[model samples]
Structure formats: C-alpha cells, structure tokens
Target: MRLSVIAKVLALPVVFFVCFFLVPLSVVLMSSLWVQNQLSFEHYLTILLDQYHWSVIWVTIKLGIYSTLICALLGYPLAWFMIRIVSTPLWRRLLVILLIVPLFTSNIVRSFGWMVLLGRTGFINETLQNMGLIERPIRFLGTELGILIGLVYILLPFMVISVGASISRIDRSLEYASRDLGAGHWETFRYISLPLTLPGLAAGSIMVFALSVSAYVTPALLSGGRVTVLPMLIYQQYSTVFNFSYGGALSIVLLLATLFLVAFANRLGSTKGGDK
Candidate 1:
C-alpha cells in the first residue's frame, strides 16, 4: 500500500513536469529539424560551417568566462565582508539592499548607465581628460570592453548572493577549530573555510557563466551592433530574418552547452566536498 502511494505521488509530479517542461522543449527540438522534407543536420551543419559564426561563439564563451572570473574575484571578498565583518544586522541589510538595487533594474537601464559613463562627455572620459591621462577620450561603447563591463555589472549579484548564503551558513566552529590548532587567518581560510564554500562558489560561477553566455540586452545595447554575440545572432534569426529553424538550432546549441557546463561544475563540486 505504501509503495503504491509513493509511486502515485511521484507519478503526478512526473506528469506535470513532462507536460510543462519536456513537451515545450521537445517542440523546439522538433522544429529545429523540420527542414526540406525530413529531419536532418543541415541546420546544425550550417551553424558549424561558418567561420564568422564560430568566432562569435568563441567571443561569447570568452566573455562569459572572463565575466564569471571577475565576479568571483570581487564577490568573494564582498560576500565575506557582508556576512562576517558586518556585525550589525541593519548595516548588513542596507548593504544587501544596495547590492540588489542594480539587479532589480532592467538590463537596458543598466547598460544605458554604462553608455553614459563610458561616452566621450561622460564622467570617466572627463576625469581622464582633466587629469591629462589621455589626449582623447577612449572608446568603450560599441566595443568588446564595453560589452564586458556591462555583462560584469549585470551578473555580479548572482555571485554575491550565492556566496553570501554559503558564507552565512558556514559553521563558525570550523574556523575556531583551525585557530585552536595554531593556524593563522590565511592558513585557516586556505585549508578550511574555502573548501567548505566551494559548492556555493561553483553554484554562483555556473549562474554567472550561463547568464553571461545567453545575455542579449546588455550586449545588444552596449555592443551597438559593432560586436556580435551568440544571443544577438539568435535574436536576429528569430526576430528579423524570421528563420525559426536556424534560431531553434542556436537555442539548442546554447542549451546543450549550458547543460554540459552545469554537469561539469556539479562533478567538480562533488569532488571538492570529497577533498575535505
């Protein structure tokens, strides 16, 4: 009776999941292949055969990786500070509010902010000019550097929130245990705390990487059509060119790539726990 109940309980969710998630995804997969009187690899083959498309894919991946790295480097310390160093709850809440303000804002607005700051008459250029740091205002908008900055700004909160949760959840006794054993702060962090936080870091990294790779708005606005990304290509195919099969193939490519990365990160995170 108990086994029957358990199976029935599981079956309901499985049905719901299939209806909601799997079915829609299946539609896309099927559509990606519906070309020229049969299912075929022509769509995917077209994606791979183009050198320029490959270059765009490479650029997108590189930008995602770079932005994720920057987020980790900056977010770790900020997370640590917010969770550990800030003893007052009110102050911590205020800091968290400030961190989230940017996240709550739309990507268009955020990228526009960057557009202003990076433009010729903007604060960054004006400061440089006043200090005689550069004879001419450097170009940031409509460039890879501009896109990178916008991406980093947009995705940084994912890193901070995930890492902060991990930092907050860490048992303080672990640090005390290390200190009791005559370990200094650096050694304690290196050997004990950091290892425990690996899962959180991995989680944050995956979020940043996936979002950065698939991001459209920030790149579209900041790149100013000068720099092309995978999302931009997909958007163009679906929106402008009206080539659904091509867009579907691109969507599948991004989805599979993201799934591969999540699997790889999960494996690494599991191994990280074993190391402790």
Candidate 2:
C-alpha cells in the first residue's frame, strides 16, 4: 500500500516528462534522421564536414569557456564573503536577494540594458573618459568581449548560489582546527576549503558553460549582427530557411556536445573529490 501511494505521487511528473520533454525530443530526433521522406545522414554530414560550422562551434565553445571562467572567478570570492564572512543572517539574505533579483528580469531586457551601457557613447565609456583612463570610447558592441560581459552578468548568480551552498555545508570546526594547528588563513582556505568546494565549483561551471553556449537572446542582441553562434545558425535553419531537418541536426549536435562536456565535468569533480 505504501509503495502504491509513492508510485501514485510520482505518476504525474513521470507522465508530464514523457508527454512534454521525451516525446518532443523524440520527434526532433526523428526529424533530424529523416530527409525527403527517407532516412539519411546528409544534414549531419553537412554540419560535420563544413568548416564554417566548425568555426561557429568553436566560437560557441570559446564563449562558453570564457563565460564559465569569468563567472567562477567572480563568484568564488562573492560566495565566500556571503557564506563565511557575513555573520548576520538578515544581511546575508539581503545580499542573496540582490544577487537574484536580476534573474527575475527578462533576458532580452537585460541584454538591451547592457547594450546601452557598453556602447561607445554609453555610461561605461563616458565614465572611463571622465577618469582620463581613455582618450576615446572603446567598441564593445558587435564583439565577443561584449557578449562575454553580458553572459557573465546573466550567469554569475547561478555560480554564486551553487558555491555558497557548498560553502555553507562545510564544517567550520575543521577550519578552526587547522588554524589551531598553526595553519595560516591562506593555507586553511587553499588546502581545506577549496578542495571541499570542488564539486560545487564544478557544478556551477557546468551550469554557466551550458547556458553560455546555448544562449540566444543575450548573444543575438549583444553581438549586434557581428558574431554568430550555433543557436543562431539553428534558428536560421528552422525559422528563416524552414529547413527543419538541418535545424534538428544542429540541435542534436549541440545537445550531445553539452552532455559530453557536462559528463566530463562531473567525472572530473568526482575524481577531485576522491583525491581530497
């Protein structure tokens, strides 16, 4: 009777997952494999063999890497401050709310906001000029750097939350013990805290990287029609060209690539955890 009750509780979600995600995904997979009412690998071949597609993939991967690195660099310190340094629960809650509030806004709106700030005549450049840091405005729009800035801004909250959760779970007594043993602060953090947080860092990196690569709106607006990513190509195939076969193929390739990288990250995290 208990087992039956548990199964009943899980039934709705299982049915929803099958009906929404798996079924649509299966349709896409079938579409990718079928061309001209016949099974063919031509679309996949076209994407795999083309140098242009490779370049777009490289760019997408590059942006993902850059975004992940930037987010990690910025996130770790902020997470540490929030989790370890902030002693007041109220203050910590406030900070967390501030960090997450931006996420509630639309991505398109955020991207547009960055556009205004990053433009040549924008606030950033104007401030730099006023500070005499630069004689002229810098070009941020239509460049990878601009896109990176937006991606980092959008994804940093995920990293912060992930790392903060890990940090909060750590045993403070361990750090106290290390300090009692004459270990310096740097030594305590480097040897004890950092290793324990590897899994969280890895998880956060995976989230940031995956979102960065597949992101469309942020990249599309920030790129200013200058740069291209895999999603953009896929969108063109489906929406503009009406080539669902090729679009489905591109979608599958991106999905597989993201899954591969995520798996690699998870394995690496596990290995690191074991070593520690």
Candidate 3:
C-alpha cells in the first residue's frame, strides 16, 4: 500500500511528461524514420550529403561560440559590478529589474528593437556619423554583425543572473583571507575568486550557447535571408516544404550538436576543477 501510494504521487509528473514531451518527440521520431511503413535513415542521409546544410550548421555553431564568449567577457565584469561594487540594495534591485524586464519581453519584440537600432539610418549609425567615425552609414542590418548583436543582447541576462547568484553565494571571508595573505587585487581575483565562480560560469556558458544555437527569430529577422542557419532551415522545411522527415532529421542534428558541445564543456569543467 505504501509503494502503491508513492507511485501514484509520482505518476502525475511521469504522465505529464509522457503526454507532453515524450509523446511529441516520439511522433517526430516516427515521422523521421517512417516512409511507406518502413524505417529508414534516408532523410538524415539527405541532410548529411548536402554542403549547404553543413555550412548552415557551421554558421550556427560559430555564432553560438562567439555569442557565449562575448557574454562571459562582458557579463563577468557586470556581475562583479553588481555584486562587489554596488553598495546600495535599491540600485542593485533596480538594475536586476532592468535586466529581467528585457528577458520578460518576447524575442520578436527584442529583435525588432535591434532592427531599428542597427539599420543604415539607425541611431548607432547616426551617432558614428556625428562623431566623424565614418563617412557613410555602415551596413549592420542583414549582416552577421547584426545577427550576433541581437543574439548577445537576447542571451546576456542568463549569464548575468547565473554569475550573480554564484557571486552572491560566495563567502566574503574567502576574499578577506586572500587579502590578509597580502595578495594583490588581481592575484585575489585570479587565484581565489575566479576558481570558485567556475561552476556558475560554466552553467551560464552552456545556457547561452544552447539558446544561441537554436535561436531562429533573431537570426531570421536580422539576417534578412542573407544568412541561413540550421533552425531557419528546419523552420522552412516544416512551414514551406512541409517535409516532416527532413525537418525531423534537421532537428535531431541540432539537438545532437548542442548536446555534444554541452557535454564537452561540462567534462572540461569537471576535469579542470578536479585537477585544481
């Protein structure tokens, strides 16, 4: 009776996952493998043999790597500023609210905001011109730079929050100990603070990287079709081509690539920590 009651309590989430997550995934897997009632890898083979497909996949991965690295470089300082530098709770709360407000808004709205800011006649170009930085409005829209900017903006808050939480949880005594050891600020940060924050950094990197890889709207809206990516290709196959098999194969490829990178990063992190 105890076991039965326990299983019944756990049943709700299991059933929910099965009905929602597993069921839809199973449907897609079946469609991808099934053709004329026989299982096949033909759809996957089609994608594997295509150069255009490989190029898009590479672009997506490259964009993700660049975005994540930039977010970390920028976010670390911002996290440090929020945690160590900010003394007042009100300002910190306000800054956190500002960060979250952008996240709460839809991607379409954020991409649209970038669309306005990155245009040839946009605010960025106008400011550069006024400062005599350029004779002409540099082309940002429908370019890789524009897409990257949008991706970074959309993904940065994740890094900040992750690192911030980690920073907040850090024992202040650790810093005091390092300082009392006659360590310089850079030495303290390099040796003591940074190593402790690695977990949060890794978590943030994975989150940003995965999201950047699968992002469609930012790339689609910013690229203006000049650039192509795996997610956009998947969208095209599903929406315009209506080829569920090919779309499923593409989706699987993206999923696998993301999983592989995340696993590698996690393993690398663990190894580094263990060695330390």
Candidate 4:
C-alpha cells in the first residue's frame, strides 16, 4: 500500500484517540503538575512518598494480581470444557449466555447482590452457621476476600471467553496426533494445548488485572468503607475534596502503571508464544 493510503486508513482512529483520550489526559497531566497556578511536582511527591498512599497502592496491586491469578486458574478448565468437552451446540450456547448475563446488569446491581450474600445475615453466613462451619457470622463485607470474590465473579467471563476463543482456534489434529503417539491427556495439554492458549490467557489476565486495579463500584460497595484502593482515593480527591490537581496526579499515575504492566505482559506473552 502507498504511504498516503496507509495514513488515510489510520487518520480517523488517530484523530479519535487524540480527541477522546489524549486531550483529556493532557489536561489532567497539566492540572496535576500545576499547584497554586505554578508548575510543581509536589502532588506527585505527596502521593508517592506517603505511607497511606503506598498502602493503598499495595492494596490495589494485590487485588489486581490476586484476581488475575484466580481467574486464570479457574477459567482455564472452564474454557477447555466449553471448547473441547461440551460438543452440544445448544448447551454451549446456554453456557455462553450464562457467562455473559452478568455483564448486562449494572455494576452497582451486581455489587449489591454480593453485598447481600456476604452480609452478616446473608444467606451464605446463615447457611454456614446453620451447618456448624462457624459459630459466628464471619466478616466478609469489609475484607480483601469479599472484594476478591466479587472481582472474580465479575471478571471470570472475560477469561473464559478469551481462552475459549483461543482453544477453539487450535489445531485438533495436533492433539490427536499426540494421543496416537501414546501421550496421555495431561502430557498433550502440557506440551501442545496450554502453550497454544498462552496468548489468550495473557490477554484475559491483563484485562482482569487492569479492571481489578481500577475497580471502584465493586470494592466500594463490598468494602463498606474499611478497605481503600487507588480508585477510591482518586474518587475521594475529586468528589469530596474537590482537588482536581491531586486527583489528576492519581489518574496519571494509574494510567502510567497500567500501561507499563500491560506492555510488559504483552511482551512476555509474545515471547512465550514465539518459544512455543
């Protein structure tokens, strides 16, 4: 293709990105750097150097990493079952609908549902208490576990869909040949199937991690004001304190961190895929 043709092809998306993303980000960046109508780095220093902020960042990263790992561990088998085991088209369609139905509902509604389930008098606690699993109602509403459970539920569909698509694209011939050569199912999966699905796994994991890190509604509703994540902090600055500069700083930091982690994951996935 001619250079001009290629440029024309890219022009619309480039313009769209600049207008919608770049412009707003530029404004935030400038706002973050300006203090009392003068250029400064104090906001960045305040966020980065404070112990409370560090704890919040740590909590955010922990939530993201844990959620991603849990999703992958659970999603892989589910995806395999969907792609390779369940051969009935009708059942597969039903399963796919079940996976996606949660997405149609608002995040608030979903989080509220979890809150009901995890509350002191919630069904889960009552059942467990009645069954003698615990003497008292365990606290889940204001804890890390509560947040994680909600995140995993919300993010599992993404992982399953991504990995299922990848698994569907793999060559069945290779697996059959491996089996013919007397390789066990586990060996075939280890050497052929798993490697082939790494790209999808990586994509899904990154998506889940990014969303978990930035998640506000689920954590806010489930946390009951006890747990704090970066997004919540940013929200507080913008909503309660009316501090755009600090909020902008937090937003830029989050954006940069997400970009860096995603880029690293993409590079790692590409390298592993190439090796396989």
RMSD of each: 2.0, 1.4, 1.6, 1.7
Candidate 2's residue-wise lDDT over 1-276, tens digit each?
999999999999999999999999999999999999999999999989999999999999999999999999999999999998999999999999999999999999999999999999999999999999999999999999999999999999999999999999999999999999999999999999998898789889999999999999988999988999999988999999999988999999999988998888788767866886
Q: For each candidate, what is the lDDT? A: 0.91, 0.94, 0.93, 0.94
Model 1 over residues 1-276: C-alpha lDDT tens digits? Answer: 999999999998999999999998998898899887689889899888989878988888889889999999999999999999999999999999999988778888888999999998999999999999999999999899999998888898899999999988889998999999999999999988998887789889999999999999999998899999999999999999998888999889888877887788788767866785
Q: Residue 66 in model 4: shift from native, Å?
A: 0.6
- Per-residue lDDT tens digits for candidate 4, residues 1-276, read 699999999999999999999999899999999999999999999988999988998899899999999999999999999888999999999999999999999999999999999999999999999999999999999999999999999999999999999999999999999999999999999998988898889889988999999999999999999999999989999999999999999999888888888898788777866786
Best by lDDT: 2
Per-prediction TM-score to the true structure, in the order listed: 0.92, 0.95, 0.95, 0.95
Least lDDT summed over 10 consecutive residues: which range in candidate 4?
267-276
Off by over 4 Å in 3: 1-9
Q: After superposing candidate 1, which stretches have Cα over 4 Å from the reference?
A: 1-16, 268-276
**What does candidate 3's lDDT look like per residue over 83-140, in tens digits?**
8899999999999999899988999999999899999999999999999999999999
